[model samples]
Target: MGKKRVIQQTEEELIQETTEIEQKLQGDVKVAKSGLREGRIYIKSTYNNTIMTLTDDKGNTIAWVSAGKIGFKGTKKGTPFAASKVAEALSAAIEKVKVSKVMIYVQGVGTGRDTALRTLAAKNIDIIGIKDITPIRHGGCRPPKVRRV
Candidate 1:
């Protein structure tokens, strides 16, 4: 005879699961905010998907989106698809936030960087300025490891 096993979950576990599910539901919908100071989006190859973070000069994150958080996965990484996806995500975040002027600081040299910017422009978001924060070194890295004779 086979024995029957019972599965038990604690209250904390249940809450965590519920919260995750709730966040997924919200991701699909467009959220709006009012009165925003500034916004920022960070893209990196090391990350699986693009990360969109809206913040003010005070460094307060008004809204944030993770790659998988907004139903983006697979080859969407560093592609125009990912860029568009991030735009969609940001659109929802600031749907209600009143933004008159915005300055974008883009980091890294990813395929999605330009696309994301275009998407924002399409949304009619006034871009006051666009700056590439990608670091620049004056010279090559530590003189190539002393070539062996």
Candidate 2:
């Protein structure tokens, strides 16, 4: 029999694992109104969840929602369906919190982006601004691969 192979994690691997765990813990719980205002909404889509922060002109978060907190997971990730669910949740939260006249800030290129925005619009949320914060860089990286003749 051949010698048994032992697997050893490098220092970088250990650090990466620890960082990932910390990030998960930090992201798992939903944060509502970290700095809520009375008349604005901020939506940020991350790889693990979608965060909706409602605020006012002064940049205070009035209320918010997270996908994980609402039992959202798996393929439900960042789809229009998820957007609708988030919208519904926000609507309910808004009613409970009594927020009005919100300006929206959307940050991401996920499928939920437009859908969620539309949902807010349909609900008559009075959006003042819609900004796409996703980064875009022009030009190809390195030389293009040779094309087949």
Candidate 3:
């Protein structure tokens, strides 16, 4: 029988690999810095679900929450109640950053749209302004062909 092959890792190599993995895990946990006052909250609502992202003035994402992220599944994730819950959770996260005021940009036409905003207001987060930025098309695409006889 051939001699068994054995691969051994040195102590330095083992420590280096473990440190790399620890750094990667630390990167996954976001730590907010102090003095983040005003920011933007973008709400994208659809028939299926609602997503909320909180970002800084320069558009760096600070925190985000969605209906699906809150353990809601399927059609229930699109409901107003789910949206409100998502907002509630996201507000708690943003509060840790000491966000005093916010400008909200709402996009899409969904039942959860108003509910999410109401939840944020209930948290007393000082909504500075709300804007509906839903896009309107100019009708550029051609019409579909008629059905065959």
Candidate 4:
């Protein structure tokens, strides 16, 4: 491979990107002005995309965001950068709802899983707990039938 080139986005482009993510989030969930104190953030990451949903303690979805909805396309949707963007957008919604304590439930084995958590932490939300809810097989596949004589 030849030298790698880093393409830089101008301020206008960066702002546009963020605006798109915000639009998607706003459309997904219209947070009530009543304000919420405790809630849950469910991050469902897959090989193709990372989706995050914010819900009140009662499990009502307040907002949700995803890499594709944040302007990432094709394979880029699965990238860690996209994941951080998703987190940023969600944090904005989280703050809007005035939620003080947040419980994060992470699922899936995707590239974005860890990056999203780090970005959310940097945004200064009062993250109370982090749990990995990824499902796992309890037992190995059944033993193969005995070889033919």
Q: Compared with the true structure, what per-residue lDDT tens digits does model 4 show for residues 1-149?
A: 89999999999998987787667655644565447888999999898999999988888888888888767879989989889889988888887788888999999999999999999999878899999999998896998899988
State residue 88's C-alpha deviation in candidate 3, in Å: 0.4
Q: Which stretches of candidate 3 lie over 4 Å from their true place?
A: 1-32
Which portions of model 2 miss their true places by more than 4 Å? 1-38, 46-48, 137-149
What's the lDDT for all of these models?
A: 0.65, 0.66, 0.82, 0.86
Q: Report the lDDT tens digits of candidate 1 across residue range 1-149.
A: 88998998899987886576447636544334557656654444223556667766665666766556655447655566666666777776666576666677777766677777787888867777877777889985777577778
What 10-residue stretch in candidate 3 is worst by lDDT?
Answer: 22-31
Per-residue accuracy of model 2 over 34-130 as CA lDDT, tens digit each: 3233466778776556778766567766567766655556766566766666776776666556566566778876677777788888884555677
- The predicted structure with the larger lDDT, 1 or 4, is 4
lDDT of 2 at 25: 35
Ranking by lDDT: 4, 3, 2, 1
Question: Candidate 1, which segments miss by more than 4 Å at Cα?
Answer: 1-33, 37-48, 140-149
TM-score versus the correct structure, for each prediction: 0.65, 0.60, 0.75, 0.75
Q: What is the lDDT of candidate 1?
A: 0.65
Every candidate's CA RMSD: 9.1, 10.1, 12.5, 5.5
lDDT for model 4, please.
0.86
Cα lDDT, model 2, residue 109: 64
